[model samples]
Target: MAAGLVELAGVGLEVERPVRTRILHPIWLTIPEGARVSLVGPSGAGKTTLASIVGALQPASEGEYLFRGERVDLLDAKARAGFRADNVGFVFQNAHLIDERSALQNVALGIIDPTVEADEVTGRCLAALQQVGLAEVADRKAALLSGGERQRVAIARALVKGPRLVIADEPTGALDQTNGKAVLELLFSLDATLLLVTHDLAAAELADQVVTIVDGTLA
Candidate 1:
């Protein structure tokens, strides 16, 4: 596959104690670099679960999963956290911003450097915020911004780390149609190897490929 950015083989997920639902099928798929993918299904399906697995937010239950040639299931918690910070960016339905922090500070959090000067961090943060069309709100607290504006700030924060993979879980759920569309457009524009979980079929269309899950099995 020549280092396809994401690849999955015989991927399956199940819960032991509850035995309530199957979360995944023995599905196999590969997504190359700069490609966009959507995992779409009704509620209770494994869309979000699959996204979590791909982004290394959670480990897989069975089979092989890889990102950038590294076996995700093999990574320890500490290593997984580092891998996610350095290579994966995630946007969720909520921005998950620190209400007390300014947009600039939130963006700066993505760049963790003890030796870097405050001005340097501020400058980089400003640039990233500008890239997401939020320069004007750089000094504003996330609590004060509108939903759309806050989502943009989240995007800026995700990009500040320059991650190769962007994983968004229902990122547009809080928006009106117009705002949702705008938020999604901004997300796709980043051109990272995208793996998204969304219920919006139109949003799924943004991806180069789509995988549908039904009753916890890829359909």
Candidate 2:
């Protein structure tokens, strides 16, 4: 078997504030390069938490996380942020775009490296928007876009940096059927490895493999 691009060994999470609560039970998973994996589960089943851990947005409270043979679970916050900037793209159910920003500007925010020149950022952002079929509205404020358009813009933002992995959490949950299908097609067409969390079986079916999470453990 090919080596995994991402691997989680006995990974889990817990919260200790109000009361010590286990948010995720230890689980193991592997995702090879260029593979598409879907995570399906009931609400509050820890799907999003697992996606966050894989995306480097949060650390696993136990066990190890390896990405491309590197130990990601050991990184500090700043280092983890850098790792994510270099390798991961994320899309959520909500577009989370700034209402006053133009589509191009919104996409440009995805480029986290401060050393990139302005013209290059602009060029890259425009290209990303073009890829999502939103070049015509590149300069339009985000508030004016339709629901589907907004989600497309979100996708463009996620793709602007040419990430190796894309983690989408309920990406099409709020869309109409047609719009949801379009979004799923767009996501599946990307060249990167995909880790998707969704409740839609049709969307999940598009993945190369589907895994179920129930009440914090893989089922």
TM-scores for the candidates: 0.92, 0.98
Write one digit per residue (lDDT tens) for candidate 1, span 112-179: 54777888888888988988998998989889999999888988888887889888899999999989
**Candidate 2: tens digits of C-alpha lDDT, residues 15-75:** 9989999999999999999999999999999999999999999898999999999999999
Instruction: Write down the worst ten-residue block by lDDT for model 1.
Output: 17-26
Candidate closest to the true structure, highest TM-score:
2
Q: What lDDT score goes with residue 98 in model 2?
A: 98
On the 0 to 100 scale, the lDDT of residue 205 in model 1 is 92
Clashes of each: 0, 0
User: What overall lDDT goes with each candidate model?
Assistant: 0.85, 0.95
Worst 10 residues of 2 by lDDT: 1-10
True-structure lDDT of candidate 2: 0.95
